[model samples]
Target: MGNITKRGSRELEGDGAPSLVEGPRTELHTELYAAIMREDCTAIQVLLSSHPINQPVTILANSTSHRFLSTQTQSIMPIHLAAKYCKAQSLLCLLEHGADPEIRDSRGLTTLHLMLLHWPISSTMWTKLGNRTQRTLTNTQKDAVRCLLILCEHGAHVNARVDDSNKYSPLHLAVAHGTSPVLSILAQKGAQVNATNESSMTPLHMAAELLNQEMTEMLIACGANVNCAVSCTGSTALKLAVCTASSKAGRLLAAGVSCIHSLLTHGATVNAQDHEGQTAIHEACFGGREAIINLLLEYEANVNILTRNGESPIYMYLQHSSNLRDRVLLTKLLYCSYPLRLTNNQGALPAGIMLPEFHLLRETLIKLSQKLLSLEDICKRVISNIYGEKHKHHLKQLLPVKMWNSIYCHDSAYLLK
Candidate 1:
């Protein structure tokens, strides 16, 4: 391998050398990079026909050739740039003209790596120009899959991970971006579906963390371990999904799909605990994900499951509730039968943890605790267990249609009623 040489600046020596980057072939390589960046396919074809196809092009964002010398300079091959910019025609033409598919850029990213990281800029670009429809977004995804197929056909390492920074395989990247098409492509091309990143997080863990139902399902179908945990924290994919979805700031879009439901459907342990001994239910409680909490409860999740720190799901719910008037959620916990008498590491009861303004909540729980369990209530609880537990497919066979609907279809808002 020829070293890129640079001169004059001591900083340049640490980054690039005088003899290589500033060499006589600089202008030709620069022009090639510009052509690829601009998606100039005609110029790319003409240039490749006249010179070496694997020529290294260094894009100097400023005066310096060494990337480390300045924030601007980046060393990339023609194919890597073409793949990143999603210049499908330019990418294919360069590949047809003999561009090496396996060339690593400054970040140790291959053309295949670029394809995995491909993003849709149509939303941003079209917003300024016009309006990009959903079809435009989908086409961007299809283009990425096409590029990946080309690289895989050229014998690109289908399971190659990012060499610099965190070791993220193409599968991990595909999961992180929630790109179902690339995921399918990678899996079909023999990519390791169970591949983990530097954190020992599998693609399922990543999909779970993003609350990406489609990707989570795909990875599971591809045989990704549903209960795969982070090596350091013992955090399962289900826990990660709950935590990620619950922690979102805006109107929780995560409530739309229950990753908890997906993982459990695939045989994930309902009470699987993380490094902190916190289950997915604990995470859902902490995030105030009422729908998820209900789903977990329906699966017979242990309501009193505690974290390593002695915090129960109820404790987490009370501690995390930003508004006490989030009463339906609070009451759902009560209805699910998490003990109000239970205390946390700080020795606070569920009521003791509440603010003064939440006296009504505290009073309601205390009053409910004193009420004798009636035969009707006992039967309803038993019926709920039979109708709503993990074997949901058996509901129609086990119960009358009206009873099943009454028990399963009702939301938390109907819990007190």
Candidate 2:
């Protein structure tokens, strides 16, 4: 319960100085501010003992100290400033003096939020530089996770929402910022793995969006919802994996396809459509992912299922030349046991619109059409055989007899002869 003391406008008062209406304007406070700025722990300790203030001094951007701290500006506290400036000693001092770790700035960010935001650079350095550099920093300084642990010890809420964005908890921020160490701490502290933001996107979604396959797998291992749909686009993490097309996408796709396998095994609907009426097949098709398409088909994806716009996965493939192989693959998959025909709702077949480059495909469709016509002629012959000459004559009357006679006979009288 130390009290801050002020002397005259120019000098500091003694420890037992009379209470003034306002706090200290002493050179001691100024020196403390400078000490905090320069990370001079020794000077800060001496100044704190002399003025004996229970509350830590707040520093503005210009490096001036305010005796009375205000949370009105941006909800920033002294510890937040210290964390932002990477002054570990000053941060510890403020924490020791009963600094509110959860005090949010105008942005609704607590000291913990600030710490997490600034923590990644340290972790990234460790990740890139190896254990020797990590030991060097750990021996001489606190790393990001250590800082997070300090904040947690000071009662910073591990799951507090960051500002009004409501997009990230400390865990989300840690993962988003690539602070692997901080992410582990947050996860261990019971941050929700499936926690979502305004976009209904879990941390896994964020990780997938960034193509952080490692983080994505970690989140999934921690029970992140693999099929959680983003609010904006209703895209699941698997869909995102197919869509990103980055190296991260490759990793996520590997993991996500496995998840998809499990989900399908456990009875998650493969044909489940999103808001746009697009299923996983649609996503694979739109993304032009030949491998993913094959995977989905292996799992019995309904190839002919139409999207909201009446476009089947094959239609989607045909729209983009980038997806030609996928289109052809889907077409083959759809027509493997059946004839190759692109029929609309009215049963009208897509004939002239055959894939221009697929010569074999065009020939197959033509042969199938001719085979169907021949089958109809055979059915007519069987009926004629059953009903005799009178029925045959009636059937011949219905036929395009003139054209048929010209093709089969040298003259109309030749058939009679």
TM-scores vs. true structure, each candidate? 0.71, 0.61
lDDT of each candidate versus the true structure: 0.71, 0.58
Per-residue accuracy of model 1 over 41-147 as CA lDDT, tens digit each: 88888777655778666544445332222245566677877788677777888888888888887688877777777655434335444335756766876676677
Q: In each prediction, how many residue pairs overlap at the backbone (N, C-alpha, C within less than 3 A)?
A: 6, 6
What lDDT score is found at residue 96 in candidate 1? 82
Clashing pairs in 1: 5-17, 5-18, 5-19, 5-20, 6-17, 6-18
lDDT of 1 at 172: 86
Quick one: best TM-score, which candidate?
A: 1
Candidate 2, residues 1-417: lDDT per residue as tens digits?
223343331132233333233344334545565676576767766776765434444322222244432222221345666776567677777778766787777677778878767663443455777788777666533545556667777777878888675658877887778765566667777788778877677887777666566676667667677777887777776556555642225666676555455444444456666777777776676666666666666555666577565656655554454444434454443432122234445554343335477656545544653454345444443343243332445546666986434322222221111
Query: Where is the poorest 10-residue window by lDDT in model 1?
Result: 61-70
